[model samples]
Target: MDAIVLLRDGLAAALTPGNLLWAFCGVLLGTAVGVLPGMGSAMAVALLLPVTFQMDPTSAFILFAGVYYGGMFGGATTSILLNTPGQASSIATTYEGHRMALGGRAPQALGTAVIGSFVASIIGTLVVALFAPTMVDFALKFGPGEYFALTVFSFVAVAAVVSGSVLRGVASLLIGLAIGLVGIDGQSGAPRFDFGSPVLLDGIDIVIVTVGLLALGEVLHVAARGRNAPDLASIRAGKPWLKRRDVRRSLPAWLRGTALGTAFGPIPGSGAEIPTFLSLGAERRLAKRREQRGGGESEFGKGAIEGVAGPEAANNGSAAGSLVPLLGLGLPTSATAAIMLAAFQQYGLQPGPVLFERNGDLVWTLLASLLIGSVLLLVINLPFAPLWARLLKLPKPYLYAGITLFSVLAVYAINASVVHLVMLIGVALLAFVMRHFGVPVAPALIGVVLGPIAESELRRALAASAGDLSILVDSGISLTLYALVLIAAFIPLVSRVRRLRAERRERETTGAGTS
Candidate 1:
């Protein structure tokens, strides 16, 4: 009953005239950012962080939540229409969504993505409302050693699961760890990687690294590749309209995707990518099984509606899922969530065990606002699909130039330091190299955000135990987390070995037949 009253109060706060206007503006801005290639909610939220300093924390957070949901929806628009995902989460959407566009069923693809996202978003929001406090309670039981173990689990899971090559992901994460080593040492007040430079003592700002790597790096890479005309002319249909068949196929897939997303959301190091890919793989297998049984034909590769529907739903669902850790444990699983963490720090807020007790109104109001934002996204996205497609019509040179310009400007505006500008360019170059070599970028961002936390916890645990390393593995939670890390790490290697063996057998069989 008390929970019900708090929820009602939160809803009332979110629906106020001023708050509603902020939600609308945030949705608009976030959608626009999502429609642009390589621009993401992280950048949007980071940019707004300095700007929203004077506003009420609740209102600023409401705006950020709106942007977060809007960006998820908007990225789907670009994926369906142009075969180009505006954000990493939308990558799976492009596999079949673009094919649907090419087949003159762009409207159908768009409809599935939007509707699936809406359903998943609502379900995810309800999850946050019901489980956040419980999660906070659970988090309070963790010690420094448990926290250290959790970070290891996160590192292994994220690196092994996210990248196509585990070695590359580990390499990227190392780079981030190395970056994290810069600045003054937490315990000794000694600088490790500053190289005698004053600017290095403060450490590289995460905002600079994020914008440089994601936003600027993408632009530089694109410019280097030279522009090609995006083939969006034939895909432009009116508003997204769902057919009966489309509804029949997408409904179950939506539910399955939502389940996968919700399950993975709070796990450290697991983000939207894993859930989206898993949903797509599941849907593909289901379609194949249906074909074998003669119940339906499988469209596994050539414009399957279920492919678009399931992954898009998972993407949005995971977005909501990431919040579970962010709000409940002060752990961020993805790049955008990392930026949100920074925002929390900026507002003098910490998002952990005491957040609910200390800031109940803010926390509940934020949850209510997320629910409100999801509805607003549905209303706003449906009508704007066509207009967003028009964004692709803009000249490539001007668009990329503008993105690069704004990225540099934003970094400079943050600290007014020439050193940051220099660091931004350097990081952009490093990101370009990583992109060229097919390195997954998220683990790097994750490492940068989580590395220091892990370091701090490790040191604390050692100090508490008189430098005994055994304490790091003493607790049940720590042991379980380490065991899970071993499982997460071993599964990928085992799967890879099995796949290679299977492929070798198939090749031998084919060679024998040819001979």
Candidate 2:
């Protein structure tokens, strides 16, 4: 009865002409932003944060959420058509998407990407609706140590070694940790690397960090490659249609990916990023084995519908999984969720255990809105993909210059501080340098966002225990967790050395052949 009430209320709220318009406008703008190279959903959301100021909070958040959903959908447009993933989530799509485009089946590929993403998103939203109650119950029981353990578990569970090599992946995680350590210390509240800059006192904003590292850093890297005035010829899909074989092959893969992706969703930091990669790797290996047995690796690389299906499901599943901490404990796992967290805070609403009691309608309504958005995305995106794909062809200078202008202006608008604009530029430069060194920027952003909370929690845990060291090891759960962290933190180094050895062997063979 309560759920029904909330659904009715939420539907009423979401379906209001004003809210519906915002949702539609959000999706359209988000899709266009995401389809453009260097203009990811994160950057788009960050850039537009200022625009939401004049809007009602409820309508604003609905729009933001719509933008997030639309951005993910739009990411595949460029990845398939141009071998360029609009964002990180679409990287795996590029492996198969570009191939499908090359085969003169661009329409079919776009259809699979959109349809698969839509179905996966719907399933994921349903999973959230059905499972959130149980997850909240489970998460409410977590102590600080348990939460810490969950974070470690997230990093370990999502390791690429499970899909590719474990060591290299672990290294990427450590890089994130190191980046998280920049700025002020959470517990002591002292600046770490402020370098005498007053703007560093408040610590790095997650939005700035992500925008700086992914967008600004990418721009610098691309500029370094001297591809300054690149021209694009749009790819076309004539009569896009999925064949019976495509359907048969993709359904199983979609189901498999959803199951696999959902299972890995709740381990703290684990999300679609790793799960998609792992799913793709699994599909590739399975396809190879099947080929060796005379089935032939038909769709594995050439936009095999399965390739599109698995990663899409994994990404959506991960998004649903990410809500676990946000609702259960007020922890935001992904950058998008972090931005949502800020939105929640703006309305003086805190998300956590009490959220259900205080704003059950809002919470349920939010969940219901997710389902609505998923359906809307599938309906809109599937038919207009070629149009979406052309969004990638927008002039880079105009787009990037506009982004640069907006990022600074947004930062200033938020605080009305000249210092913030300076801070944004500084981060942009730091992010660019960080990328030149091959460092993964996501962890750093996660670190900056999570660092303060983790520190605060650690201190609270100690104060509650009256500073006894035993508190850290008091529970079997904590001991087990620490041991797991130790294992995860070291695995990447070991994996890297192993990979180097394999490469060396191949190199030696080539050198000997030349001799």
Which candidate ranks first by lDDT, i.e. highest?
A: 1
Candidate 2 lDDT over 24-120, as tens digits, reads 8777777777765445566677777778877777777778767877887787776776555566666566667767776666677788876776677
Model 2 bad stretches (over 4 Å): 1-23, 29-65, 75-110, 153-175, 227-240, 244-249, 256-308, 321-366, 392-515
Poorest 10 consecutive residues of model 2 by lDDT? 157-166
lDDT tens readout by residue for model 1, 1-515: 67667888999999999999888888878888886655668778988999999999999999999899888877777677755466767767876887888776777787788888889998887876777666545545678898788778767766775576889989998988888888999899988899889999999987687667666776677777763534445455666778788889999999999987876677665567667767876787689779879987898678999998899889888888888889878999787899999989999999986888899999889888887887888888777556655554567777667767767776787679999999999998998899889896767866776799899989999999999999998888889989988987887788779889999999999999999
Best by TM-score: 1
TM-score computed on alpha carbons, candidate 1: 0.74
Per-prediction TM-score, please? 0.74, 0.68
